[model samples]
Target: MTKHLSTPLANSMGIQDQVSFHRTELAIILSLYGRMVAAGEWRDYGISALKNLAVFSVYRRTAEVPMYRIEKRPKLRLQQGQYSVVGMDGKVLRRGRDLKQVLRVLERKLIRAVD
Candidate 1:
């Protein structure tokens, strides 16, 4: 067998890379995270890169489900945008082409002062 080292060959062999958030994407997300942390709204977070999507989960406390999840799905980029914010109940809070815009849904909740 001969070796075909090319992009087409790799694709033909079904070599798919996992989708992940870029450094800049994470930076923006983290900026909000930092603010939430300081406000005591969020205590922990998790990141997951899967075959079709990347997820950033925010938690108020450990050992429980995430309060919110930010997901990036390139497959939906052309249709309904890529960035999405999901609530803890698994509902889509916001979805948009711009990450910052989708992220604003969460930021709105942070605007109020904690009693």
Candidate 2:
């Protein structure tokens, strides 16, 4: 004879516990990434989908720390907007509700790099 146990952990196993970028959001980020890569300003990138937030980390090299991190926090969507771009030093360079607008900060660098 076997007994079945019901727990909160077990109940959540079937659900997706992590947050991630939507297709349209990824398109916006990747578009910026492609441009940066083409300009030789970025080399590698990483993505992390965590329980509360999703992060897109940009790297100049694989072994080094990420140069920038674009993050999406759904919890902040109502308060301070969900989209944010963080610098290498862990500073919030930009934050807004619109992903494309927030990403413009990085795009400015591309302009500088190209000039």
Candidate 2 lDDT over residue span 22-102, tens digit each:
999999999999999998999999999998999999999999999999999999999999999999999999999999999
Tens digits of per-residue lDDT for model 1 on 2-41? 8956689778899888899999999999999999999888
Question: If scored against the real structure, what TM-score would every candidate get?
Answer: 0.85, 0.85
Off by over 4 Å in 2: 1-16, 113-115
TM-score of 1: 0.85
**Candidate 2 has which clashing residue pairs, if any?**
none
**Count of clashes, each model:** 0, 0
